[model samples]
Target: MKFSVFQLSRRGARARNEDRIGYCYTREACLLVLADGMGGHAAGDVAAQIALNSVCALFQARATPLLDDAPGFLAEALLHAHRQILRHAQQHHLADAPRTTLVVALLQQGQAWWIHCGDSRLYLARAGALLARTRDHSFRAMAERSGQPPASVNRNLLFTCLGSPSLPISDQAGPWPLARGDRLLLCSDGLWDALGETELLALLAHDPVSLCVPRLVDRALQHTGASSDNVSAIALEWEMPGAQSAPDSISTDALEGDAFESTLQLDAPDLPEPAPPVPALPEDELSEAAIERTIAEINAAIRRPGERRR
Candidate 1:
Protein backbone atom coordinates (compact mmCIF):
# COMPACT_ATOMS: atom_id res chain seq x y z
CA MET A 1 0.00 0.00 0.00
CA LYS A 2 1.10 3.50 -0.71
CA PHE A 3 -0.05 6.68 1.08
CA SER A 4 1.00 10.11 2.24
CA VAL A 5 0.74 10.76 5.97
CA PHE A 6 1.43 13.61 8.38
CA GLN A 7 0.83 14.51 12.04
CA LEU A 8 1.12 17.64 14.17
CA SER A 9 0.65 18.71 17.81
CA ARG A 10 0.73 22.03 19.65
CA ARG A 11 0.80 22.82 23.35
CA GLY A 12 -1.21 25.97 22.77
CA ALA A 13 -1.97 27.86 25.99
CA ARG A 14 -1.58 24.84 28.19
CA ALA A 15 1.45 24.39 30.39
CA ARG A 16 2.10 21.04 28.77
CA ASN A 17 0.62 19.06 25.95
CA GLU A 18 -1.49 16.12 27.06
CA ASP A 19 -2.43 15.02 23.56
CA ARG A 20 -0.55 12.25 21.75
CA ILE A 21 -0.59 10.99 18.16
CA GLY A 22 1.27 8.41 16.09
CA TYR A 23 1.20 5.77 13.36
CA CYS A 24 2.93 2.49 12.63
CA TYR A 25 2.96 0.16 9.67
CA THR A 26 3.99 -3.36 8.75
CA ARG A 27 4.25 -4.72 5.23
CA GLU A 28 0.48 -5.17 4.93
CA ALA A 29 -1.14 -2.93 7.55
CA CYS A 30 -1.02 0.53 9.08
CA LEU A 31 -2.20 1.73 12.50
CA LEU A 32 -3.06 5.35 13.27
CA VAL A 33 -3.79 6.47 16.82
CA LEU A 34 -4.50 9.66 18.77
CA ALA A 35 -5.23 10.19 22.45
CA ASP A 36 -6.41 13.29 24.29
CA GLY A 37 -5.64 13.09 27.99
CA MET A 38 -8.44 14.51 30.14
CA GLY A 39 -7.21 17.63 31.90
CA GLY A 40 -9.48 17.00 34.86
CA HIS A 41 -7.16 14.24 36.06
CA ALA A 42 -3.56 14.17 37.17
CA ALA A 43 -0.85 12.90 34.85
CA GLY A 44 -3.02 13.40 31.76
CA ASP A 45 -0.01 13.37 29.47
CA VAL A 46 1.16 10.15 31.07
CA ALA A 47 -2.19 8.56 30.37
CA ALA A 48 -2.08 9.61 26.70
CA GLN A 49 1.46 8.29 26.40
CA ILE A 50 0.53 4.98 27.98
CA ALA A 51 -2.41 4.56 25.63
CA LEU A 52 -0.19 5.10 22.59
CA ASN A 53 2.57 2.81 23.89
CA SER A 54 0.20 0.03 24.89
CA VAL A 55 -1.66 -0.06 21.58
CA CYS A 56 1.37 0.32 19.33
CA ALA A 57 3.26 -2.33 21.27
CA LEU A 58 0.40 -4.76 20.81
CA PHE A 59 0.14 -3.85 17.12
CA GLN A 60 3.86 -4.46 16.66
CA ALA A 61 3.54 -7.92 18.18
CA ARG A 62 0.30 -9.00 16.50
CA ALA A 63 0.74 -7.54 13.04
CA THR A 64 3.61 -9.79 11.99
CA PRO A 65 2.38 -8.75 8.57
CA LEU A 66 -1.33 -8.10 9.09
CA LEU A 67 -3.85 -8.68 11.86
CA ASP A 68 -5.83 -11.89 11.70
CA ASP A 69 -8.96 -10.05 12.83
CA ALA A 70 -8.77 -6.28 12.58
CA PRO A 71 -11.99 -5.44 14.45
CA GLY A 72 -11.39 -7.99 17.17
CA PHE A 73 -7.84 -6.82 17.61
CA LEU A 74 -9.06 -3.25 18.03
CA ALA A 75 -11.58 -4.23 20.74
CA GLU A 76 -9.10 -6.27 22.73
CA ALA A 77 -6.42 -3.65 22.33
CA LEU A 78 -8.68 -0.93 23.80
CA LEU A 79 -9.49 -2.99 26.87
CA HIS A 80 -5.81 -3.81 27.25
CA ALA A 81 -4.90 -0.16 27.09
CA HIS A 82 -7.58 0.67 29.65
CA ARG A 83 -6.19 -1.98 31.98
CA GLN A 84 -2.71 -0.59 31.54
CA ILE A 85 -3.90 2.89 32.60
CA LEU A 86 -5.56 1.43 35.66
CA ARG A 87 -2.35 -0.43 36.45
CA HIS A 88 -0.41 2.80 36.23
CA ALA A 89 -2.73 4.40 38.76
CA GLN A 90 -2.41 1.40 41.07
CA GLN A 91 1.37 1.37 40.79
CA HIS A 92 1.62 5.03 41.61
CA HIS A 93 -1.14 5.02 44.25
CA LEU A 94 -2.81 8.00 42.67
CA ALA A 95 -6.00 9.52 44.13
CA ASP A 96 -7.66 9.05 40.73
CA ALA A 97 -6.67 7.18 37.61
CA PRO A 98 -5.54 9.33 34.71
CA ARG A 99 -8.06 9.46 31.87
CA THR A 100 -7.89 9.92 28.11
CA THR A 101 -9.96 9.81 24.92
CA LEU A 102 -8.67 7.37 22.29
CA VAL A 103 -9.23 6.87 18.57
CA VAL A 104 -7.51 4.31 16.34
CA ALA A 105 -7.76 3.42 12.67
CA LEU A 106 -6.33 0.34 11.01
CA LEU A 107 -5.76 0.24 7.28
CA GLN A 108 -5.01 -3.00 5.56
CA GLN A 109 -5.75 -5.01 2.38
CA GLY A 110 -7.52 -2.03 0.75
CA GLN A 111 -9.99 -1.42 3.59
CA ALA A 112 -10.17 0.56 6.83
CA TRP A 113 -11.33 -0.22 10.37
CA TRP A 114 -11.54 2.00 13.45
CA ILE A 115 -12.49 2.15 17.14
CA HIS A 116 -12.84 5.05 19.52
CA CYS A 117 -13.59 5.97 23.14
CA GLY A 118 -14.58 9.44 24.32
CA ASP A 119 -14.37 12.58 22.18
CA SER A 120 -11.35 12.04 19.98
CA ARG A 121 -12.43 11.47 16.37
CA LEU A 122 -11.68 9.90 12.99
CA TYR A 123 -12.89 11.54 9.79
CA LEU A 124 -13.00 9.92 6.34
CA ALA A 125 -13.33 12.27 3.38
CA ARG A 126 -13.67 11.50 -0.32
CA ALA A 127 -13.73 13.84 -3.29
CA GLY A 128 -14.46 17.00 -1.25
CA ALA A 129 -17.24 15.45 0.81
CA LEU A 130 -17.31 14.17 4.38
CA LEU A 131 -17.96 10.49 3.94
CA ALA A 132 -17.94 9.68 7.65
CA ARG A 133 -16.98 10.99 11.07
CA THR A 134 -16.97 9.41 14.51
CA ARG A 135 -19.57 10.61 16.99
CA ASP A 136 -18.35 12.06 20.28
CA HIS A 137 -19.05 10.28 23.60
CA SER A 138 -20.11 13.40 25.47
CA PHE A 139 -23.55 13.95 26.95
CA ARG A 140 -24.05 17.04 24.78
CA ALA A 141 -23.37 14.95 21.71
CA MET A 142 -25.76 12.27 22.91
CA ALA A 143 -28.45 14.81 23.60
CA GLU A 144 -28.09 16.33 20.15
CA ARG A 145 -28.38 13.00 18.41
CA SER A 146 -31.21 11.61 20.54
CA GLY A 147 -33.30 14.78 20.35
CA GLN A 148 -33.15 15.16 24.12
CA PRO A 149 -32.99 18.60 25.69
CA PRO A 150 -29.35 19.64 26.14
CA ALA A 151 -29.93 22.35 28.67
CA SER A 152 -27.00 22.70 31.06
CA VAL A 153 -25.03 19.94 29.36
CA ASN A 154 -21.32 20.52 29.44
CA ARG A 155 -19.78 20.06 26.03
CA ASN A 156 -16.47 18.84 27.41
CA LEU A 157 -17.93 16.30 29.79
CA LEU A 158 -17.67 12.79 28.39
CA PHE A 159 -19.68 9.83 29.64
CA THR A 160 -16.84 7.33 29.20
CA CYS A 161 -13.10 7.18 28.78
CA LEU A 162 -10.12 4.93 29.38
CA GLY A 163 -8.89 4.87 33.03
CA SER A 164 -12.29 5.65 34.56
CA PRO A 165 -13.52 3.21 37.22
CA SER A 166 -16.07 1.70 34.84
CA LEU A 167 -15.15 -0.18 31.70
CA PRO A 168 -14.98 2.27 28.81
CA ILE A 169 -17.64 2.12 26.08
CA SER A 170 -16.25 2.29 22.57
CA ASP A 171 -17.53 2.39 18.99
CA GLN A 172 -16.07 0.39 16.12
CA ALA A 173 -16.61 0.95 12.41
CA GLY A 174 -15.44 -0.04 8.96
CA PRO A 175 -14.25 -2.64 6.52
CA TRP A 176 -14.95 0.36 4.31
CA PRO A 177 -13.33 0.05 0.91
CA LEU A 178 -10.69 2.63 0.12
CA ALA A 179 -10.66 4.40 -3.19
CA ARG A 180 -7.55 6.24 -4.36
CA GLY A 181 -7.27 9.72 -2.74
CA ASP A 182 -9.44 8.79 0.23
CA ARG A 183 -8.30 10.76 3.27
CA LEU A 184 -8.64 9.61 6.87
CA LEU A 185 -7.84 11.86 9.80
CA LEU A 186 -7.60 10.87 13.46
CA CYS A 187 -7.44 13.82 15.84
CA SER A 188 -7.94 15.07 19.36
CA ASP A 189 -11.03 17.21 20.07
CA GLY A 190 -8.69 20.15 20.35
CA LEU A 191 -8.52 20.50 16.58
CA TRP A 192 -12.15 19.82 15.72
CA ASP A 193 -13.64 21.83 18.56
CA ALA A 194 -11.90 24.89 17.21
CA LEU A 195 -12.56 24.38 13.50
CA GLY A 196 -15.87 23.82 11.72
CA GLU A 197 -16.56 20.74 9.61
CA THR A 198 -16.62 22.68 6.38
CA GLU A 199 -13.18 24.14 7.05
CA LEU A 200 -11.70 20.74 7.81
CA LEU A 201 -13.28 19.08 4.77
CA ALA A 202 -12.07 21.81 2.46
CA LEU A 203 -8.50 21.59 3.73
CA LEU A 204 -8.33 17.81 3.71
CA ALA A 205 -9.92 17.43 0.30
CA HIS A 206 -7.51 19.56 -1.67
CA ASP A 207 -4.01 19.11 -0.28
CA PRO A 208 -1.53 16.38 0.57
CA VAL A 209 -1.85 15.32 4.21
CA SER A 210 1.50 16.86 5.11
CA LEU A 211 0.35 20.31 4.11
CA CYS A 212 -3.23 19.91 5.22
CA VAL A 213 -2.34 18.77 8.74
CA PRO A 214 -0.13 21.79 9.47
CA ARG A 215 -2.66 24.26 8.14
CA LEU A 216 -5.48 22.64 10.06
CA VAL A 217 -3.50 22.71 13.30
CA ASP A 218 -2.42 26.30 12.78
CA ARG A 219 -5.96 27.43 12.16
CA ALA A 220 -7.16 25.70 15.33
CA LEU A 221 -4.47 27.28 17.47
CA GLN A 222 -5.13 30.70 15.99
CA HIS A 223 -8.86 30.44 16.49
CA THR A 224 -8.58 29.55 20.16
CA GLY A 225 -5.60 31.77 20.83
CA ALA A 226 -4.38 32.30 24.43
CA SER A 227 -6.74 29.63 25.67
CA SER A 228 -6.42 26.99 23.00
CA ASP A 229 -6.37 23.37 24.03
CA ASN A 230 -3.56 21.03 23.03
CA VAL A 231 -4.21 20.66 19.32
CA SER A 232 -3.18 17.42 17.61
CA ALA A 233 -3.98 15.62 14.35
CA ILE A 234 -2.71 12.78 12.18
CA ALA A 235 -3.96 12.13 8.64
CA LEU A 236 -3.32 10.04 5.55
CA GLU A 237 -4.26 10.00 1.88
CA TRP A 238 -4.81 6.52 0.56
CA GLU A 239 -2.84 5.03 -2.34
CA MET A 240 -1.17 8.17 -3.66
CA PRO A 241 1.23 6.97 -6.31
CA GLY A 242 4.93 7.72 -5.92
CA ALA A 243 4.93 9.90 -9.05
CA GLN A 244 2.33 12.26 -7.54
CA SER A 245 3.72 12.03 -4.02
CA ALA A 246 4.56 14.87 -1.67
CA PRO A 247 7.47 14.47 0.78
CA ASP A 248 5.37 12.45 3.28
CA SER A 249 4.45 9.61 0.94
CA ILE A 250 5.10 6.06 2.13
CA SER A 251 5.04 2.81 0.22
CA THR A 252 5.03 -0.48 2.11
CA ASP A 253 5.63 -2.65 -0.95
CA ALA A 254 9.33 -3.06 -0.23
CA LEU A 255 9.10 -4.09 3.41
CA GLU A 256 10.09 -7.56 4.52
CA GLY A 257 7.44 -9.89 5.96
CA ASP A 258 8.64 -9.18 9.51
CA ALA A 259 9.45 -5.51 9.13
CA PHE A 260 7.72 -2.85 11.25
CA GLU A 261 7.87 0.95 11.18
CA SER A 262 6.45 3.38 13.78
CA THR A 263 6.41 7.01 14.85
CA LEU A 264 5.08 6.50 18.41
CA GLN A 265 7.36 8.10 20.96
CA LEU A 266 7.71 8.37 24.76
CA ASP A 267 9.79 11.46 25.48
CA ALA A 268 8.83 12.82 28.89
CA PRO A 269 11.62 12.24 31.40
CA ASP A 270 9.42 12.61 34.46
CA LEU A 271 6.98 9.87 33.52
CA PRO A 272 7.80 6.24 34.21
CA GLU A 273 8.40 3.88 31.30
CA PRO A 274 5.36 2.02 29.97
CA ALA A 275 4.65 -1.53 31.06
CA PRO A 276 5.20 -4.57 28.84
CA PRO A 277 2.81 -5.37 25.99
CA VAL A 278 -0.42 -7.07 27.01
CA PRO A 279 -0.57 -10.65 25.78
CA ALA A 280 -3.69 -12.05 24.16
CA LEU A 281 -6.01 -13.68 26.68
CA PRO A 282 -6.31 -17.44 26.83
CA GLU A 283 -9.74 -18.92 26.04
CA ASP A 284 -10.31 -19.92 29.63
CA GLU A 285 -9.40 -16.45 30.82
CA LEU A 286 -12.14 -15.01 28.60
CA SER A 287 -14.91 -17.48 29.36
CA GLU A 288 -18.54 -16.47 28.83
CA ALA A 289 -19.28 -16.38 32.57
CA ALA A 290 -16.30 -14.10 33.17
CA ILE A 291 -17.47 -11.76 30.42
CA GLU A 292 -20.94 -11.48 31.97
CA ARG A 293 -19.46 -10.83 35.41
CA THR A 294 -17.30 -8.04 34.07
CA ILE A 295 -20.30 -6.48 32.34
CA ALA A 296 -22.26 -6.58 35.57
CA GLU A 297 -19.42 -4.85 37.38
CA ILE A 298 -19.27 -2.14 34.73
CA ASN A 299 -23.02 -1.59 34.95
CA ALA A 300 -22.84 -1.17 38.70
CA ALA A 301 -20.00 1.28 38.39
CA ILE A 302 -21.82 3.32 35.77
CA ARG A 303 -24.93 3.60 37.91
CA ARG A 304 -23.00 4.86 40.91
CA PRO A 305 -22.88 8.64 41.36
CA GLY A 306 -19.69 10.63 40.99
CA GLU A 307 -18.40 13.95 42.39
CA ARG A 308 -19.22 15.46 39.00
CA ARG A 309 -20.83 14.03 35.90
CA ARG A 310 -18.37 13.12 33.10
Candidate 2:
Protein backbone atom coordinates (compact mmCIF):
# COMPACT_ATOMS: atom_id res chain seq x y z
CA MET A 1 0.00 0.00 0.00
CA LYS A 2 1.11 3.57 -0.73
CA PHE A 3 0.24 6.69 1.28
CA SER A 4 -0.40 10.31 0.33
CA VAL A 5 -0.06 12.89 3.13
CA PHE A 6 -0.38 16.62 3.82
CA GLN A 7 -0.16 18.82 6.95
CA LEU A 8 -0.88 22.46 7.73
CA SER A 9 -1.09 24.96 10.62
CA ARG A 10 -2.03 28.62 11.04
CA ARG A 11 -1.73 31.06 13.95
CA GLY A 12 -5.34 32.14 13.43
CA ALA A 13 -5.15 35.50 15.26
CA ARG A 14 -3.53 33.99 18.34
CA ALA A 15 -0.40 35.44 19.94
CA ARG A 16 1.48 32.20 19.28
CA ASN A 17 0.39 28.97 17.66
CA GLU A 18 1.03 26.24 20.21
CA ASP A 19 -0.20 23.34 18.10
CA ARG A 20 2.35 21.00 16.49
CA ILE A 21 2.03 18.14 13.93
CA GLY A 22 4.32 15.74 12.02
CA TYR A 23 4.84 12.14 10.94
CA CYS A 24 7.50 9.48 10.39
CA TYR A 25 7.51 6.48 8.08
CA THR A 26 9.75 3.63 7.05
CA ARG A 27 9.29 1.18 4.21
CA GLU A 28 6.95 -1.05 6.17
CA ALA A 29 5.67 1.25 8.94
CA CYS A 30 4.50 4.83 9.46
CA LEU A 31 3.61 7.04 12.41
CA LEU A 32 1.52 10.19 12.55
CA VAL A 33 1.58 12.54 15.58
CA LEU A 34 -0.31 15.67 16.57
CA ALA A 35 -0.49 17.83 19.74
CA ASP A 36 -2.32 20.84 21.15
CA GLY A 37 -0.49 22.78 23.81
CA MET A 38 -2.53 23.64 26.92
CA GLY A 39 -2.71 27.44 26.62
CA GLY A 40 -3.58 28.39 30.22
CA HIS A 41 -0.23 27.02 31.35
CA ALA A 42 3.19 28.58 30.84
CA ALA A 43 5.27 27.57 27.82
CA GLY A 44 2.64 25.29 26.39
CA ASP A 45 4.43 25.21 23.04
CA VAL A 46 7.48 23.94 24.85
CA ALA A 47 5.56 20.97 26.12
CA ALA A 48 4.16 20.31 22.69
CA GLN A 49 7.56 20.43 21.05
CA ILE A 50 9.12 18.19 23.68
CA ALA A 51 6.32 15.69 23.37
CA LEU A 52 6.69 15.41 19.59
CA ASN A 53 10.47 15.36 19.67
CA SER A 54 10.66 12.65 22.30
CA VAL A 55 8.35 10.39 20.34
CA CYS A 56 10.27 10.99 17.11
CA ALA A 57 13.53 10.22 18.87
CA LEU A 58 12.21 6.89 20.04
CA PHE A 59 10.91 6.11 16.58
CA GLN A 60 14.31 6.84 15.10
CA ALA A 61 16.09 4.56 17.57
CA ARG A 62 13.87 1.56 17.10
CA ALA A 63 14.14 -1.03 14.37
CA THR A 64 12.94 0.78 11.30
CA PRO A 65 11.20 -0.78 8.25
CA LEU A 66 8.83 -2.68 10.55
CA LEU A 67 8.00 -2.77 14.25
CA ASP A 68 7.85 -6.03 16.10
CA ASP A 69 4.93 -4.71 18.14
CA ALA A 70 3.36 -1.45 16.99
CA PRO A 71 0.96 -1.07 19.94
CA GLY A 72 3.68 -1.69 22.49
CA PHE A 73 5.95 0.86 20.81
CA LEU A 74 3.21 3.48 20.86
CA ALA A 75 2.39 2.92 24.54
CA GLU A 76 5.99 3.07 25.65
CA ALA A 77 6.74 6.08 23.45
CA LEU A 78 3.87 8.06 24.98
CA LEU A 79 5.02 7.20 28.50
CA HIS A 80 8.55 8.28 27.68
CA ALA A 81 7.18 11.57 26.39
CA HIS A 82 5.40 12.01 29.74
CA ARG A 83 8.67 11.60 31.60
CA GLN A 84 10.47 14.04 29.33
CA ILE A 85 7.86 16.66 30.18
CA LEU A 86 8.38 16.07 33.91
CA ARG A 87 12.14 16.38 33.54
CA HIS A 88 11.75 19.65 31.67
CA ALA A 89 9.51 21.04 34.42
CA GLN A 90 12.07 20.14 37.10
CA GLN A 91 14.95 21.56 35.12
CA HIS A 92 13.17 24.88 34.62
CA HIS A 93 11.64 24.91 38.12
CA LEU A 94 8.24 25.68 36.69
CA ALA A 95 5.54 26.04 39.33
CA ASP A 96 3.12 24.48 36.90
CA ALA A 97 4.42 22.23 34.16
CA PRO A 98 3.60 22.94 30.56
CA ARG A 99 1.03 20.47 29.27
CA THR A 100 -0.31 19.22 25.93
CA THR A 101 -2.87 16.78 24.50
CA LEU A 102 -1.45 14.25 22.02
CA VAL A 103 -2.57 11.67 19.46
CA VAL A 104 -0.35 9.20 17.58
CA ALA A 105 -1.13 6.62 14.88
CA LEU A 106 1.08 3.81 13.67
CA LEU A 107 0.48 2.00 10.41
CA GLN A 108 2.15 -1.30 9.65
CA GLN A 109 1.40 -4.59 7.95
CA GLY A 110 -2.03 -3.54 6.58
CA GLN A 111 -3.44 -2.35 9.91
CA ALA A 112 -3.42 0.83 11.99
CA TRP A 113 -2.81 1.16 15.74
CA TRP A 114 -3.15 4.40 17.66
CA ILE A 115 -3.24 6.15 21.05
CA HIS A 116 -4.28 9.50 22.47
CA CYS A 117 -3.96 11.54 25.67
CA GLY A 118 -6.47 14.28 26.34
CA ASP A 119 -8.62 15.77 23.57
CA SER A 120 -6.63 15.92 20.36
CA ARG A 121 -8.41 13.59 17.90
CA LEU A 122 -7.85 11.05 15.12
CA TYR A 123 -10.60 10.29 12.64
CA LEU A 124 -10.89 7.58 10.01
CA ALA A 125 -13.14 8.05 7.01
CA ARG A 126 -13.85 5.40 4.42
CA ALA A 127 -16.16 5.15 1.41
CA GLY A 128 -17.92 8.47 2.00
CA ALA A 129 -18.67 8.09 5.74
CA LEU A 130 -17.21 8.35 9.22
CA LEU A 131 -15.79 5.05 10.40
CA ALA A 132 -14.22 5.96 13.77
CA ARG A 133 -12.93 8.81 15.91
CA THR A 134 -11.42 9.35 19.33
CA ARG A 135 -13.51 10.38 22.35
CA ASP A 136 -12.09 13.21 24.41
CA HIS A 137 -10.65 12.57 27.85
CA SER A 138 -12.26 15.67 29.33
CA PHE A 139 -14.55 15.99 32.32
CA ARG A 140 -17.45 17.32 30.27
CA ALA A 141 -17.12 14.51 27.71
CA MET A 142 -16.96 11.95 30.48
CA ALA A 143 -20.07 13.42 32.04
CA GLU A 144 -21.91 13.39 28.72
CA ARG A 145 -20.96 9.79 28.04
CA SER A 146 -22.03 8.66 31.52
CA GLY A 147 -25.52 10.21 31.12
CA GLN A 148 -25.22 11.61 34.61
CA PRO A 149 -26.10 14.91 36.28
CA PRO A 150 -24.06 18.12 36.01
CA ALA A 151 -23.85 17.74 32.27
CA SER A 152 -23.09 21.41 31.86
CA VAL A 153 -19.45 21.88 32.73
CA ASN A 154 -16.35 23.43 31.16
CA ARG A 155 -15.35 21.23 28.26
CA ASN A 156 -11.79 22.55 28.55
CA LEU A 157 -10.99 20.80 31.81
CA LEU A 158 -9.02 17.76 30.62
CA PHE A 159 -8.55 14.83 33.03
CA THR A 160 -5.28 13.67 31.50
CA CYS A 161 -2.31 15.17 29.59
CA LEU A 162 1.46 15.04 29.36
CA GLY A 163 3.44 17.22 31.84
CA SER A 164 0.94 17.20 34.70
CA PRO A 165 2.47 16.15 38.00
CA SER A 166 0.21 13.11 37.98
CA LEU A 167 0.89 10.16 35.77
CA PRO A 168 -0.58 10.53 32.29
CA ILE A 169 -3.20 8.09 31.03
CA SER A 170 -3.67 7.31 27.33
CA ASP A 171 -6.30 5.30 25.48
CA GLN A 172 -5.30 3.17 22.48
CA ALA A 173 -7.32 1.96 19.53
CA GLY A 174 -7.17 0.07 16.26
CA PRO A 175 -5.43 -2.73 14.40
CA TRP A 176 -8.26 -2.15 11.96
CA PRO A 177 -7.59 -3.35 8.46
CA LEU A 178 -7.06 -0.49 6.04
CA ALA A 179 -8.96 -0.20 2.80
CA ARG A 180 -7.35 1.16 -0.36
CA GLY A 181 -9.03 4.54 -0.12
CA ASP A 182 -9.20 4.92 3.65
CA ARG A 183 -8.53 8.47 4.84
CA LEU A 184 -7.04 9.37 8.22
CA LEU A 185 -7.25 12.79 9.79
CA LEU A 186 -5.36 13.72 12.95
CA CYS A 187 -5.96 17.18 14.38
CA SER A 188 -5.99 19.43 17.42
CA ASP A 189 -9.23 20.59 19.05
CA GLY A 190 -8.78 23.85 17.15
CA LEU A 191 -9.67 21.98 13.97
CA TRP A 192 -12.21 19.30 15.03
CA ASP A 193 -13.99 21.34 17.73
CA ALA A 194 -14.67 24.15 15.29
CA LEU A 195 -16.26 22.00 12.61
CA GLY A 196 -19.29 19.70 12.70
CA GLU A 197 -18.71 15.97 12.27
CA THR A 198 -20.91 15.78 9.20
CA GLU A 199 -19.07 18.64 7.52
CA LEU A 200 -15.73 17.02 8.28
CA LEU A 201 -16.87 13.69 6.87
CA ALA A 202 -18.01 15.36 3.68
CA LEU A 203 -14.64 17.01 3.17
CA LEU A 204 -12.78 13.77 3.81
CA ALA A 205 -15.03 11.79 1.56
CA HIS A 206 -15.03 13.96 -1.56
CA ASP A 207 -11.95 16.19 -1.67
CA PRO A 208 -8.45 15.03 -2.45
CA VAL A 209 -6.45 14.60 0.75
CA SER A 210 -4.15 17.52 -0.13
CA LEU A 211 -6.89 20.05 -0.85
CA CYS A 212 -9.34 18.99 1.85
CA VAL A 213 -6.92 19.63 4.72
CA PRO A 214 -6.11 23.27 3.91
CA ARG A 215 -9.75 24.07 3.25
CA LEU A 216 -10.73 22.44 6.52
CA VAL A 217 -8.21 24.53 8.43
CA ASP A 218 -9.33 27.68 6.68
CA ARG A 219 -12.97 27.00 7.45
CA ALA A 220 -12.14 26.15 11.04
CA LEU A 221 -10.24 29.41 11.48
CA GLN A 222 -13.15 31.37 10.01
CA HIS A 223 -15.66 29.39 12.02
CA THR A 224 -13.85 30.16 15.25
CA GLY A 225 -12.72 33.67 14.14
CA ALA A 226 -10.53 35.73 16.47
CA SER A 227 -11.20 33.49 19.40
CA SER A 228 -9.90 30.58 17.39
CA ASP A 229 -6.99 28.72 18.90
CA ASN A 230 -4.09 27.56 16.77
CA VAL A 231 -5.42 25.42 13.95
CA SER A 232 -3.50 22.37 12.63
CA ALA A 233 -4.13 19.03 10.91
CA ILE A 234 -2.60 16.05 9.11
CA ALA A 235 -4.45 14.39 6.24
CA LEU A 236 -3.37 10.99 4.98
CA GLU A 237 -4.78 8.75 2.28
CA TRP A 238 -3.84 5.11 1.86
CA GLU A 239 -4.07 4.72 -1.89
CA MET A 240 -3.81 1.27 -3.35
CA PRO A 241 -2.89 2.03 -6.94
CA GLY A 242 -4.71 0.15 -9.69
CA ALA A 243 -7.04 -1.44 -7.15
CA GLN A 244 -10.86 -1.55 -7.15
CA SER A 245 -12.79 0.97 -5.07
CA ALA A 246 -13.01 0.24 -1.34
CA PRO A 247 -16.02 -1.44 0.23
CA ASP A 248 -18.72 0.57 1.98
CA SER A 249 -17.88 2.43 5.20
CA ILE A 250 -17.63 0.42 8.37
CA SER A 251 -21.01 -0.69 9.68
CA THR A 252 -22.30 0.35 13.10
CA ASP A 253 -22.86 -3.29 14.06
CA ALA A 254 -19.37 -4.51 13.19
CA LEU A 255 -17.73 -1.33 14.56
CA GLU A 256 -18.82 -2.02 18.13
CA GLY A 257 -15.83 -2.12 20.54
CA ASP A 258 -13.51 -2.27 17.53
CA ALA A 259 -12.52 1.38 17.72
CA PHE A 260 -11.13 1.40 21.28
CA GLU A 261 -8.08 -0.81 21.70
CA SER A 262 -6.83 -0.31 25.30
CA THR A 263 -5.39 2.17 27.76
CA LEU A 264 -2.13 2.52 29.70
CA GLN A 265 -1.19 4.56 32.77
CA LEU A 266 2.26 4.77 34.31
CA ASP A 267 3.16 4.93 38.00
CA ALA A 268 3.68 8.41 39.37
CA PRO A 269 2.98 10.27 42.61
CA ASP A 270 -0.47 11.81 42.69
CA LEU A 271 -0.59 15.53 42.13
CA PRO A 272 -3.09 18.01 43.52
CA GLU A 273 -5.54 19.50 41.09
CA PRO A 274 -5.29 23.17 40.25
CA ALA A 275 -7.70 25.56 41.99
CA PRO A 276 -8.91 27.07 38.71
CA PRO A 277 -9.69 24.91 35.73
CA VAL A 278 -7.08 25.29 33.01
CA PRO A 279 -8.08 27.16 29.88
CA ALA A 280 -7.69 25.20 26.66
CA LEU A 281 -6.60 28.51 25.14
CA PRO A 282 -5.86 31.80 26.86
CA GLU A 283 -8.86 34.14 27.05
CA ASP A 284 -6.72 37.20 26.59
CA GLU A 285 -4.56 36.09 23.66
CA LEU A 286 -6.96 35.95 20.70
CA SER A 287 -9.62 38.54 21.40
CA GLU A 288 -10.23 40.42 18.13
CA ALA A 289 -13.25 38.48 16.85
CA ALA A 290 -15.43 35.82 18.44
CA ILE A 291 -16.16 32.79 16.21
CA GLU A 292 -19.69 33.93 15.33
CA ARG A 293 -18.50 37.07 13.50
CA THR A 294 -15.47 35.47 11.89
CA ILE A 295 -17.17 34.35 8.68
CA ALA A 296 -18.20 37.83 7.59
CA GLU A 297 -14.78 39.21 8.36
CA ILE A 298 -13.14 36.33 6.55
CA ASN A 299 -15.17 37.06 3.44
CA ALA A 300 -14.50 40.78 3.66
CA ALA A 301 -10.83 40.20 4.27
CA ILE A 302 -10.66 37.96 1.23
CA ARG A 303 -12.37 40.58 -0.94
CA ARG A 304 -9.96 43.35 0.07
CA PRO A 305 -6.71 43.96 -1.82
CA GLY A 306 -3.48 42.55 -0.27
CA GLU A 307 -5.28 41.51 2.95
CA ARG A 308 -4.61 37.85 2.21
CA ARG A 309 -0.87 38.43 2.58
CA ARG A 310 -1.16 39.07 6.30
Q: Which candidate leads in lDDT? A: 1
lDDT (C-alpha) at residue 118 in model 2: 96
Model 2, global lDDT: 0.70
Where model 2 places Cα greater than 4 Å from the true spot, the runs are: 149-151, 241-310
Cα deviation at 82, candidate 2, in Å, is 0.7
- On the 0 to 100 scale, the lDDT of residue 56 in model 1 is 73
Error of 2 at 141 (Å): 0.5
Candidate 1 per-residue C-alpha lDDT over 95-160 given as tens digits, one digit per residue, 9 for 90 to 100? 899999999999999999999999999999999799889999999999999898787699999999
Candidate 1: which stretches are off by over 4 Å? 240-247, 265-310
Model 1: how far residue 69 lies from native, Å: 0.3
Cα RMSDs, all models:
9.4, 15.4
- The 10 consecutive residues of candidate 2 with the worst lDDT sum are 260-269
lDDT of 2 by residue, 82-127 (tens): 8878877999888988999999998877788899999999999898
How big is the RMSD of model 1?
9.4
